[model samples]
Target: MAPVNEAARPALKAGTRDAHERRIDRAVALIERAIAQGEEPPELGRLAEAAAFSPFHFHRVYRAMTGETTGQTVARLRLLQGLRLLASERRSVTDAALAVGYQTPQAFTRALRQSLGTAPSELRAEPERLWREIDRLAQPPQPEQGEDAPPLRVEVVSIDPFQVVALRVEGGYEAKHAGYERLFGWAGAHGLLDRLQGLYGVAVDDRRDVAEPQCRFDCMLALGEGVDPTGLPGLRLTRLGGGRYARIRHVGAFDGLEAATDALLARWLPASGERLGDALLYHDYLDDPDQVPQALLRTDVYLPLQC
Candidate 1:
């Protein structure tokens, strides 16, 4: 990846930057709670209060940070959850439509097709096939000598095959931790939490490649032999593709991701000869920054290589 020439971008003052981040985090929490409840969303004023910002500014900043209005964010979340239900429960298209608060089936299908790029029927069929494969691999013995580790570059290396009990997430990256929370909650409910030994935040879309902020990511719980991926509620088992990358590990909250990513693109990539690959530069969380000390976040980032 070549260094991104950001000579024209403005720099933020330190104090103002911190204040902005704190405000953004508060706003994100309010919206996430509303989605998890899955009922009538809170009023705009109430949400503004929760974020400690005036309603007018709240609406503007919330959209600025998350790339969608509060209302749009909640609506998209319901639709993603509805799609999951459709794939896993094999619910009638009509029922799935209504479950997500859609008034009519036609409306739901139309939106689903636009977002997913496939008809409901075709989408449903793919899950069925994935489920079957996951079920079949239900206790394969680990290779005695596991191989496939490649030179630690910032490039995507072909990863060895593995199964995961995953929850599909569709939204901007800013709201994704909520999806991870729900996924972890589901794992706990099913006694699968212990099985997430090698957790992965599987990003299907690279933000660097697309201008739109509306993209989906799959927050996957790495599965061992005991976890069955078949017929699980909104669960999926997938094989991740690998290639080249530019990797880094940053300590602290995901809030600094944009800055860290920018640094990698502007400072590091140019220093090295590697070019960003077609795949998104990947970030692997090695330690829970919340639990670990400030200096010990084992987050490894990978940027794809070109030459």
Candidate 2:
């Protein structure tokens, strides 16, 4: 994969997304940098302040983007630091542990074992395996599906500019049904209902990072030519500046969306000559979950690509 180009056009188009998306991306990048430098991940309160989110909400947002709780991500990063110290710097076992904030060498070894299924001593003899172990353990298990699941199809396509009437709700990952319920209710009460052109959703945060109540999700519907959402309760006008997107289809139930997204970034994007950046992640819902069975619902995941 080519290196990330900070000045890419996709990064420029990212300005079209809600500002909060950019803030969250910045906060995550900060935490990632801290960990890479062998420093402690910032405290929740401090991170929240930096991200311009409340402590309670930022935790959930962090999980949504990284697919791991803050503590889990930090632990993994620290262990990685320990591996670098031991292998690359040739630090002693005890010193290496201390370098990454572990109180004792034994504690570090235990964590390494738990996370990688390999003890420190074993890895010391074969240091190259540390990264391999990290990759193996990070992969989420793919959901089981029979031949009924649609074959994965991918395309690089340009999206046209469009506007959405959306509402942000905080809840657990699978519980987003209630948010959409509220959105539809408000839309109906305002007599703004129309023949659906396209159903849409923006994942504002991840559930795995916090309590279900704290996870933030955005659900929206495309604005029809004559539809006006002005003064509508709980609905805000969001404009997505369309650009080239690497659109991939998820053909199974919603439960597998996280894993599918993970696979797209970790397994495919790198080799596809693309780099992930500040561009807003958007979800295009093609089928209504209410009308269609869970197994048949289709959602397209879009990641902005540099033109």
Query: lDDT tens digits, residues 61-122, model 1?
Result: 45444445566666666666566667666589887777766778888778766755567777
Lowest summed lDDT across 10 adjacent residues in model 2 is found at: 1-10
Q: Write the per-residue lDDT of candidate 2 for residues 1-307, one digit (tens) a residue.
A: 1112232233223333345446666776676678666577788787777876566445644554455666876676677667777776557989888877887889998998786777888887775686676565444223233235544455666676677778787776455777677767777876767645677787776555457787778888775545566664666877653666767788878767766665555444433555443456778888887789989999888776656
Worst 10 residues of 1 by lDDT: 1-10
> What overall lDDT, based on C-alpha atoms, would model 2 receive against the true structure?
0.66
Give TM per candidate: 0.39, 0.59
What lDDT score goes with residue 158 in model 2? 67
* Cα error, candidate 1, residue 98 (Å): 44
